[model samples]
Target: MNEQLIHSKITSMEIDVLRAVKQRTLEKFTEGPSVERARLFFLLLPYFDGKHWSGEIEASAKTVSIVYAALHAHDQVKENASATKKQQLTVLAGDFYSGIYYQMLANLNNITMIQRLATAIIKVSEKKASFHDGLDRTTAELDRSVQQIETELLATFYNFYGFDHYTPLATLMLSYIRYKDELECLQGGSETRIIRSLNETLQHPLHTERWLLEKLDNLHDQISLTINSYNFNYDLKNFMLHQITPHQHRAEQLTREG
Candidate 1:
């Protein structure tokens, strides 16, 4: 399929997801559940790539997205601070999305998937907690934690549906996207849990920036190599590179600056 058509299909799935979890009070008070487009693209990648897709598989994909939204909502809840009404509503929204995902899987009679997702959620929770647990982790360990946190649920979905081949690409792209966000947060004079941990580990903001730049360059190279390994058509590959992950090498930037 062409890129536009692929994007259109992804947008359709996104709308369906948003409708599935929309709540009046949450819409009014909280930011509501985040249904990210890039994530939706990855969740539906198999379908996009002409894998055997059923309605059941589509439903499972939606539930996976809902799970991510639920976790993202909970992540927005402030720690060690008094809860405001919005904060309370945000918590409720997270719980509400969690229930929606459970009910969705239950309706589909996907008990196996539910069990698998529960394990993935536990792993993701543990990884998130590691950032604040005051335990010293090596950069490799920290990268693994971040990878699990970002892609575990999606990886679960991929594994369940025999699309595990996509896991490596998904992990790299998601991690690159995450580090891109962290780099932006740092440049914007804001701090996040990941940034704080990274700063503590790397020993300075400058080091963190350098690490992020090098990581992005590495991931982009991997993505270029991995994309060629797949049997994707021109439009699909082009869309993934140009739309999902446009990269500019840091070394090239430095050379031009010099």
Candidate 2:
């Protein structure tokens, strides 16, 4: 099948995912369902490239993206103990998304991917917890954990369908995107677990910024190499490259005479 057909199938599944996870309270309080098109495109890339594709496979892929959105919503939850109602619902949003993914997979009878993704989530959570543990972690270890958190769910889906070719590029690109956001949070004077852990190790926020810049540069190089390893067409490769990395941030403007 062609790319358009693959994308259509994935989109249909995504609609179902949103329907499955819809809740009155969540719809009212938390941010609405975040069915990111970029992630859906990547999830369906293997199918789009003329690999072994099926309705069940597409369904599983949609669930995988939902899992990502779920975890991403939780990541937005403030570390503040005095979280407001919206923030509390944001925490439940992740858990609710997790339930939707589980139920969708069960309906598909693809128990194997469910197990695999669950295991991947466990590892991701453990790595996230490590950052909260008051221990200094080396830059390399921190990078690895961030990577696993960024790509493990998608990688689990890919690996299940023998589509491991995209894991390296996805891992590099996703992790780079994550660190970019963290850098913005740091500049905005907010705290992230990774940034907090990095501050502990580096002993200053400036050092944290330096470390993130170096990490983003290195990930860009790695992403370039990993993309070359894939047998994707020029258009597909160009789309992923232009859209994913090397991601650039817009310059901030300030009124000096104010």
Candidate 3:
């Protein structure tokens, strides 16, 4: 599909997801479910590449996104701080979204998928907890945790549907997107847990910045090489490269800064 059409489909899917998990109190107080366009694109990548797809698969994908939103809401809860009403509602919103996902899957009679996604959620939660557990993780180990945290649910969805070929690409692209967000946060003088962990590991924000820049460049290179190995159409390739993961080299960035 063309880029515009691809985007249109993602937006439509986002609307469906929002509709699936809409709640009045959550909508009124907390930030509603954040269905990222990039994630939706990756979830629908198999369909966009002309693989077998059905209404059931689409519903399963929506549930995956809902679960992500649920986890994200919990992630927003403050650490070691008294629970404000917003935080309390955020926790409730997470649970509420979790229930919606389970109910959606049950309605579709996708017991296997529900089980698989539950396992994926367990893995994701474990990796997320590692950030607080002070396990003395190396930077590489932490990177792996980040990768699993970002892609495990989608990976489970893909594996359940026999689209394992997209796993590596999704891992690379999602990790790159995540680090890009972290880099932006660093540059903007905002510290996220990921940034704090990296700073602790690398021993300085400067080192963290350098590492993130190199990581993005490396991921972009891998994406370029990996994209060629797949039989993606020109439009799909273009959309992924230019739209979803447009890259600027560190050198280019420096030159622009100069």
Candidate 4:
């Protein structure tokens, strides 16, 4: 599929996921969901490739997206002394989305997927908690945790439906997108948990930034090679290059100007 079609499909799935989990009070008070476009693109990638897509599969995909949003909401909670209203509601929002995902899967009689995803969530939460528990991790250990934090859910979904072929590319691309944003946050001095943890792990913010930039470059090369290794068409490859993984946001900016 072309990028336009892929984007439209993802937007529609996103709207459905949002509506399924929407609550008026949460919408009025909280920072809504953090559904990233990159995750959605990977969730819909098998379908975009004209694979074994059905309404049930699409519903399952949406549930995975909701699960991502749910976990992402809780990750926003700071480590210490945050009793703010937003913090309180953010906790509830995460729980609420978790429940919605369970119920959605139950409705489809997908108890197996629910079980698998629950396991994935457990692994993810353990890695997330490792940060706060003050476990002294080396840079390599931290990188492993970050990969699970970013790709476990999507990998579970793909593995469930024989779409596991895309796992490597999806993991690399999504992790790249995350570090890209983390680099921006470092430059902006935002001090997210990932940044703070990485700074401590790397012993300096500048080292963390350099590590991130190097990882992004390495992942870009891996993604380029992996995408070509697949039998995807030119349009899909173009979308992966220009839309999914590029040299940097600078490449995207120059493309727009040209």
Clashes of 3: 0
Error of 2 at 161 (Å): 0.8
Task: Give lDDT tens digits, candidate 3, residues 150-218.
Answer: 999999999999999999999999999999999999999999888889999999999999999999999
Clashes by residue pair, model 3 = none
When superposed on Cα atoms, how far off is each prediction in RMSD?
Answer: 1.1, 4.0, 0.8, 3.1
lDDT of 4 by residue, 170-213 (tens): 88888888888888899898887788889998999989987887
TM-scores for all predictions: 0.98, 0.86, 0.98, 0.93
Give the alpha-carbon lDDT of every model: 0.93, 0.80, 0.94, 0.88
Model 2 has a clash total of: 0
lDDT of 2 by residue, 38-142 (tens): 677778788667689888887888788888878888877877668799998989899889988898898988888889998988988898888888777888888
Candidate 3: regions farther than 4 A off: none
Candidate 4 collision pairs: none
Ranking by TM-score: 3, 1, 4, 2
Q: Which model is ahead, 1 or 3, in terms of lDDT?
A: 3
Model 4's alpha-carbon lDDT is 0.88
What pairs collide in candidate 1? none
Ten-residue stretch with the least lDDT total in model 1: 134-143
lDDT of 1 at 46: 94
Quick one: best lDDT, which candidate? 3
lDDT of 4 at 89: 92
